[model samples]
Target: MATKSDEDRASSYEPSSAGSDESHIPDVQNDCCNPLEETKYIVSESMLMELFNVCRRCQRLATPTVHQRVGTMVKIAAECEFCGFTWLWCSQPHVGSIPAGNIGLSASILFTGALPSKFLRVLRCIGVATLTQRTFSNHQASLLFPVVARVWDRQQRDYVTRAEDRGKPLVIGGDGRADSPGHCAKFGSYSTIDLEEGTVIDIQLVQVMISFQRTILCCTTMVL
Candidate 1:
């Protein structure tokens, strides 16, 4: 079982202002609310390569040509060794699971002009703590959605500019607004990417409304 410390208890994990208006939605609580400690589970690069060699030898011998079979069997016998209880397998999927680099959460907080440390701290706490839930409450979901939207928007702009530079017809889809405006009184947008030109050309925003009376006030722009 995980242990909680004084720091954990003292921490005030505030949800991001991006979704503050959605506060009428229920709060997301975790059974283990503390920040998780890092665990060392990955094998070193050199060791992983060595394990690959063993797998290759086993696979090579498992082939059934007579002349190569003897050589293959000998090689397999020599390399069929296990270093520890952990089994070695192809590293592609495993490597994909490991984060290549940090998201620079601390740097973002330091550079943001108006946001205070307390607020950033709260966001960081909530972001890291709720990572395992897979799904989030409406409020929690909205908190992180804008960040993703901004990134997507930037990438789309870059791709479109590149395509225009290449003198391509920037085909685009018409925007659609939902009939019912949600608590945010905003719409959801969708776009299709022109993979050949690496551009997002078709774009649409559809409005949606939530009838729930508990809906919170929607602000034009989020203030940190």
Candidate 2:
């Protein structure tokens, strides 16, 4: 049912570096903050081994060994059997002990508002190995969440300062949504936005018990 153009477009969305040695094993250096360093590739293990078959230093036949494989990250070493030359390669750059690939994937899942379990399931179904849910949760809690909190705090402070400097009341709107329909809802989020600025100014999450009204009151109090 698909036309050639449709297939081409679909294939274009695939990772450009898939199964390619040049992109799979980058020369990861101290420059981990490079945006290009964050790009991830899905590589075929067999094809990658071919590049390691000959030592770069000696041009002799070499044996490739996988030193470690952590989810999408792999550490490989090649040793020349004839000339005794050796070198190492890594599938991704590192942030201290944590692989950049793992952090990048975790951050993407959270930033895109994707449900972690379902997103991870799709990745596994496609045979693209990735960090597990536990690791994702840990990354969110330890690394991503703190960064988000700090940035959000700074943004909110800036907004408040700007509003005070303008010497005019902010034109704002507020709305609340329940997690589930009707009285059975146990959780809800209420958000406020600056209508003039067209930006969300605050979001408050609350747990519902006796009534949704009570949760709305809590959200309002926190926002205030």
Scored by lDDT, the top model is 2
Q: Write the per-residue lDDT of candidate 1 for residues 1-224, one digit (tens) a residue.
A: 11246325323334443432211322323244221232324343344344334334344312111111110011112233433222322211111111111112222333463344464456446432211122233322432344445555556556545765777454432233334544454655544445455444545444444422111121101100
- Candidate 2, residues 88-117, lDDT tens digits: the string is 887777554466777788888999999999
TM-score of each: 0.25, 0.72
lDDT of prediction 1: 0.32
RMSD of 2: 12.9
Q: How many backbone clashes does candidate 1 have?
A: 6
RMSD of 1: 20.4
lDDT (C-alpha, whole model) for all candidates? 0.32, 0.70
